[model samples]
Target: MTGQVSVAGLGPGHEAQITPEVSAALAGATDVLGYIPYVARIAPRPGLVLHASDNREELGRARAALDLAAQGRRVVIVSSGDPGVFAMASALFEAVEATGRTDIDIRILPGITAMLAAAARAGAPLGHDFCAINLSDNLKPAALVEHRLRHAARGDFAMAFYNPRSASRPDGFGRALQILREECGPGRLVVFARAVSTPEERLAITTLAEARPEMADMRTVVLVGNSHTRRVGGWVYAPRSATVSAPASDPEGDA
Candidate 1:
């Protein structure tokens, strides 16, 4: 049958926040492929085959899911956040596209992204227009990250940063801060969310200048505010965009 396959979001850090539909899809799945840490977040659902892999073998893990799907197994490829949002969905599609095989049906059941989870936990700081950028240079050049950061500042759009820092890419976090500072100013609101939905979760609301590299990790996501986003009542908030109401036209008279 080449069963319906999916890259499921496990929610940011815990099993409780997993959506019922996603959980059901996973429960029905014959196999699941993901990094070891995210795989550990799932409870032992019987009859499910786990293909846990080391974090570094992203492509390998994704290929495992594709292989399982090709085998007519209801396979679920899990990700920490929404699979499409800086996660596994793209990689899966890319892999299939490279192989020139789109015969397998793939579905993406969305889940709570880390940025959204963190934003809601604090406040609606992303109420306005926003963009998310991955700071990791492993896939893209650091210069490209800097260029995007510069434009985001000039456009005055709120931004969420994914993969803010890691041991291999130690300079991404600091460099992002530097570009934002150069484009904006020192007082802009920046929130650092770590281990969202997990026991070790930490959320810090501070300015760009005050964000320290020591607290950031691969799980960390940084939200850098536009000029409008403000910190009040221990929360970060962005005001709604202004919209001018159009003058109502008389239905019959205008005609």
Candidate 2:
């Protein structure tokens, strides 16, 4: 009895946002593994076994899931949003590569990522060319983060950021805001969508000049608009067309 593993997204904390494919995977899974909060989203049932681990244990969790699947147990790994976007699907593949376990069955299911959910809730801030970047320094360097920010701003691409700040890195987001202000100028639109689709959801719209580091935390997704992004009525959106601008230069001579 060969078993399979499915990496599925639950879609940013709303049960309604969860797709039918993910729901069906959960219903048929004999074992589910994920971060503590994500695994908690799965309901307990007669034959389903849940394995919850810490946020930093993604590789180990993937290995455990693969191990279970190799033993003929149907497994599902749940991520809050789309598994491939800064989530478990990549980690699972990394584990597969490291272990050379190409024989195990694997499936990647798509779901609405937090940035998209946030963008939708706010209107269409991502309506134009955009890029998503994770700001956490857990696996990357701070200099690299600033480098990407500079390029994104220079290219005038609408930007979405995940893991903007946390208690441990209290000042990183402040520094990021400073870089954005330098490259994009003071009037560029910025939106902070926190816990979108949940009961405690909050949305704040402002500009690079007024954006405070305190407005964002680990749970918040920050959106910085391109030069052409603007507010219409009460909603914010980027136009579908692009007006190329000269390459941006740092005002402060930091570059």
Best by lDDT: 2
In terms of TM-score, the best-performing candidate is: 2
For candidate 1, write residues 1-255 as lDDT tens digits. 676679899889777788998988877888888889888776676898888888767777777777787888888888988999988898888888777668988899899999999898779889898989988888888889988887677667789989898888887788778878877788989888988888889998888778777668988888888788887798899888633222232224465
State each candidate's clash count: 0, 0
Residue 163 of candidate 1: its Cα lDDT?
89
State candidate 2's TM-score: 0.96
Residue 10, candidate 2: C-alpha displacement in angstroms: 0.5
What would the per-residue lDDT of candidate 2 be over residues 24-90, giving only the tens digit for each residue?
Answer: 9999999999999999989999999999999999999999999999999999999998999999999
Worst 10 residues of 1 by lDDT: 242-251
In model 2, the runs with Cα more than 4 Å from the true position are: 249-255
Tell me the whole-model lDDT of each prediction, alpha carbons only.
0.82, 0.94
